[model samples]
Target chain A: MAEDVWILGIRMTKFGKHPDRDLVELAAEASMGALADGGVTMKQMQILAWGSIMSGGMGQQLQKQIGQTGIPVYNVANACATGATALRTVIMAIKAGEADFGLAVGVEKVAGAGLLAGGSRGVDGTTWTPRGPVGAVAPLDGRIGTETMPGVFAQIGLEYGHRYGGTSFELFAKISEKNHAHSTLNPLAAYRKRFTLDQIMNDVMIAYPNTRPMCSANADGAAAAVLVSDTRLRTLSLEQQHRAVKVSASVLTSDPWEEACQVLPDVNTLTRNAATQAYEAAGIGPADLDLVELHDCFATAELVHYDNLKLCESGGAVDFFNSGATWRDGRIPVNVSGGLQSKGHPISATGIANVWEICHHLRGEAGDRQIEGARVGLAHVIGLGSACGVHILEKAAA
Target chain B: MAAARIPLVDYLRLADEPYLVASECEECAARYFNHRVACANCGATAFKEAQVPADGVVRAFTIVSFAAPGIEVPFVSAVVDCHGTSVRANLVNVAPDPEHVRTGMAVRLTTFPIGTDSTGTEAIGFGFEPAAD
Candidate 1:
């Protein structure tokens, strides 16, 4: 049987613009902080998995800055799922018995970076490049259908409303209001101010039914984690073992064919598949999750994900939100870290950052936003390249 | 002599009976707007050119009010279900507002001027407009 893996330590830099700091600086802070937290050194780590979207050889560059241990490195980039993908790579290495201790880190510096071009790797600059059919010099986004993230997600939310009645413009805005309200408690969030419903509603509309506040705040940040095999974890001090959180389930899934999924990336089915697999692996259901930190890239995404994650009955997302179950004090509090709305989304960093949030609560380290007596938690991220990752964690026993 | 006109996309036919072309997977009949090296659904390498019906229903839509620099906003972007195949396009010939457009609205393919070049040639793009029910 494969050995179980536990998160020995996790650290996330404050999620906001660090204009002066580049990717390496941000990554070094997170990596060194995680190493210190784990009470380990770079020489002790057997492998390193680094995740980032910016182009460059990050792992080797980081190794030079931190230490030249000559450890094997796996540089990963899976859109927004890069962080989770990197962490999962380390977990797989540990399970394969390649080495007992490993480190995973994700970082990105996207502050002031404008709209995302739907998941396509096409060139987007002042110069027109001929790539797609027809040799079009520019992106077909505003000209044809919108391949922009805001437009894509806006259509998705509206489509969900059209299929499942009872969803309206206000409901989606209310979800954003909830996330913005929660952001006040998270000091590391990029935008911590709470917005009134009117403020969120009347804010400059990016897409119909989705305003500026409803969209995620793009920022620069990094998150890192240290993983240890169960055998190694047992040999550690009692204090370290007690603080370690068990990796109950780690799953990643891509889009499955449905009629219209090609046109609209199937965020729903992929997430459902990941959540189902995670539940089976963890041997627990959504009800068992004390808190959750899901990818709320947009407020519209949060509501649909509530249903996709099976947090509520089929087509019960609106009611679930209405019941206030996703609030900090609700039945199953979700995104108490203000989510991507205010907490900021640094792309690659978001995945490990989410796991970092859950580990804090699991270790009783989450300060004001902590869910009291929190035990089991889940972190979910869906990159529109159509990849979804779900990680479930369990608190260590005293 | 008339000015030359070009279809903005390769799949759009500018012939008398203008219609969109899709690469249909021979195995699962999956259709793709762009050229596909292989079938995403069945991994089949075989495909055939399939003409898409001009008429479609609005399955979903959004009126984008904000956009990247140099791109106009407040346009109606929609996913139209055309004879089982989904096509992404902008909705035209109607008010770009919720009160004017809605899901299930019938629409038909139309063409509009994208821009004109120094050679007096015009580039045309495709869109969907409200069809008389």
Candidate 2:
């Protein structure tokens, strides 16, 4: 039988622009924090995996930073889901019985990175390269598609508003305010200040319907998780066992090219598909969840996922918010860690960062922002390919 | 001198009067906008060449105020369902406002120059315009 996995330790650096720190130092800080949290030493980690985007050859360099133990290291990149991908990799290693104690680290330095600062700079910056689609019916079919995440998501907000017929823009503002307010309680959050709905709505518009506050910042940070298999947990010390949080379900799904046909592609068909699978794998539904940490790359994205994850009816998101269903003290409190909206989305680090937040909830250690009796928590992230990874964790069976 | 023209995408070639080219799958009657190695729908490799009608309905659109450094701002980005396939591009020849660009609006495919090379060669790309009656 495949053995169950437990998050023995999870930690992340305070998310913000760490211009003084490079990727290796960021990763080392996170990994060491995780190691200390799990009560494990570098020598004990059987395998190490990293989730990074565009770090060229930082995988081996990071290993050296943590003391080259000659352990097998895997570098993974799946857009924004990179960190969760790393976590999933370690889960697979433990499931395959190839590893006992594993470490999964996700890191990204988006602050000064050319793209992170915004705009497509590089050798290709000024070059007008027209790469036409395969069979554009007309010369101009689908030509203005920009890779700016905000642009695409803003389009989704507009379409969703048109389809549903409501003040989605207002709802978006409320969502931003809620998340920013939550950030005030989260010390690890990148932007810890609260925002009024007017402030969020009036902020400079990056894309129509999406203001600066509505979109997560280009952030820099790293998060790491220590995973120990059930078999190994039996031998671990009492402290390790006490810190262990059970993984009830973990699922990752990529875009089904057909999703392109959807009017709001960013409404995320993949998240729906993955969430259903994750709920099934966890043997629980959205109703049973005590807390959730979804992508929230954009406020509208979060509103869309509320329906995609079956947390509420399709158009009931605004109502869900009004009813206080997703408030930090509501029926199913969400983003109490402030989410990517406030916590900072360091691309690759977001995956494990979500995990770290959920672990805090599951372990009953999330001091001020903690949800009462948050026994079940969900962590979700959607990559640019529209890839989605949903993971469910619960307090280990006593 | 008449500037040389180029297609932004590999599949595109001409800058003038350029219409969309597409591929049809033999296995499942699935049609693609351009030639694809395999059928996205039914997964059959057998394909036939076809061209999509230049018209589609505006499924969704946005006004992009920020983009890559070189890309212009405040353009109307849109997803037009051309020939059963979703094509994402900017809606041109229209104001970047809700009153001007609307969902379910009729749009026609058109191409415009993205930029010109210093060597007098212009790179052209495609977009959608409000369909004329």
Candidate 3:
């Protein structure tokens, strides 16, 4: 018999600073919340998959708080893909019959703890040129100019402008303006303060067209999920099954490592490939998406992704934003929960946050940030180097 | 006269007009800005050295405001399309303002000193400046 997987419970801490708190506290808080929501206890957790950038051995550390369980635990980390990758492991293990119940939890404290606590590798580890703009400091292999993350994306924005005429700087500002405004409605967001287009444009420049307001703020938070096999789910009551959202599709992919340069917003090849498979698996297309919670770590990224995800034609983003099609009441609302820009990005927690937000929308539980009658949702996250994780979610069939 | 110095890359020359070192895939005829161990286009390992023109059109550019330690902020970094190969370099001799630096502008490669070592060997690196008429 083919195994079907379902998300039984989802929980996320308010994404903000908790400097005095450590990873164990953050992880357990979300983990316990998920268990409570799903009507499960630590005794039922058969497998564990933990996610983070640094502060390793999360599954073990978290076990101490929840009671030491002699179960198989996996520590998974793939940059920004940490959350999705961790959640996917849980699904895979449950599908393979290794376990009937699994937990996926992720936590980080980058915003409050500083950069070293965040995941910045110092010097000598670049796979690209003597220098690439992915680092904020000069790496061991390259000069200082090629280090900041903003620099890499800035280069991409520039190329987009050159290739198909231009990627309007105003367009990227509007993305920031919209996302910040959306965040005002989400109390869980780290930054709920809104900014106008003029304010966003006038903010300090991080890299070229990307202003300080255009980048995602580092944050501290945790998000978790509880997954169970359909066999186990069938044993639950009708009310439990009503809240279970189906994990329709999940895909993880990496770069081809070919000898060539990458364009920032033009980084569509890998994502485009992921989209084709995920949509096919979900039995849906871009037009079918009721809501999306994706990696908008940067405002510019949101613009490029709308095209990469094939939601619109290439070079159509300039008009896409102006049409308000992505607004909360628009046809396909994006980041209605404020996204990374307003919600705060804790790296490891981001993917799980997206999953959490989408699940809430699917269940009609999202309060102020709800997308009206959303039926299907997509959660996407990308890690530089890079790894891409995309998942599609829908209501489970009765 | 200043002492002669070598470029950061073996193929990059700093003695005269600045230039770039490139490689071409024998199988696919695709070119690259720096040397390649294998052809990313066709997966062929055999590659021969290729020369790139000093001047090319700017495909994209950014003025880096917050940068690594010791780097001057508000410096213009550019991705230049040198013939068919793409080169990542900083833009020099031009104002770092959007009004001045823009995509599709003409640029030419130039070499600059990157400080000397204990052995008195200066490190030479390459950048692009607005092209001459």
Instruction: Give each model a TM-score.
Output: 0.95, 0.89, 0.91
The segments of candidate 1 whose C-alpha lies over 4 angstroms from its true place after superposition are: A118-131, A134-139
* lDDT for B38 (candidate 3): 77
Candidate 2 C-alpha error for residue A121, in Å: 8.8
Worst 10 residues of 2 chain B by lDDT: B8-17
Off by over 4 Å in 3: A112-145, A257-259, A262-266, B9-11, B23-43
Report lDDT (CA) for all predictions. Answer: 0.89, 0.79, 0.78
Please identify model 2 stretches exceeding 4 Å from their true place: A112-143, A259-267, B1-18, B110-125
Q: What tens-digit string does per-residue lDDT give for candidate 3 at A1-398?
A: 44888899989999988878898899999999998888888899899999999777668889989967898899999988899999999998988899899999988888843222111335333222234322121222123235466667667666665766547778788888888998998888999999999999999888878898888888999999999899999999887899998998888877654423532223556677778889998899999999988778778778767776777778776577678988788877888888887899989989888999999988989887788778899998888768888999997654
What lDDT would candidate 2 get against the real structure?
0.79
Candidate topping TM-score: 1
Going through the candidates in order, their DockQ values are 0.56, 0.43, 0.40
Tens-place lDDT digits, model 2, residues A124-242 = 43444543344222233124465567777777766666667664568788888888999999998888999888898888877777888888867899999999999999898887787
Error of 1 at A132 (Å): 2.5
Q: Considering the true interface contacts (CA pairs under 8 Å between chains A and B), give the fraction that model 3 also has.
A: 0.33
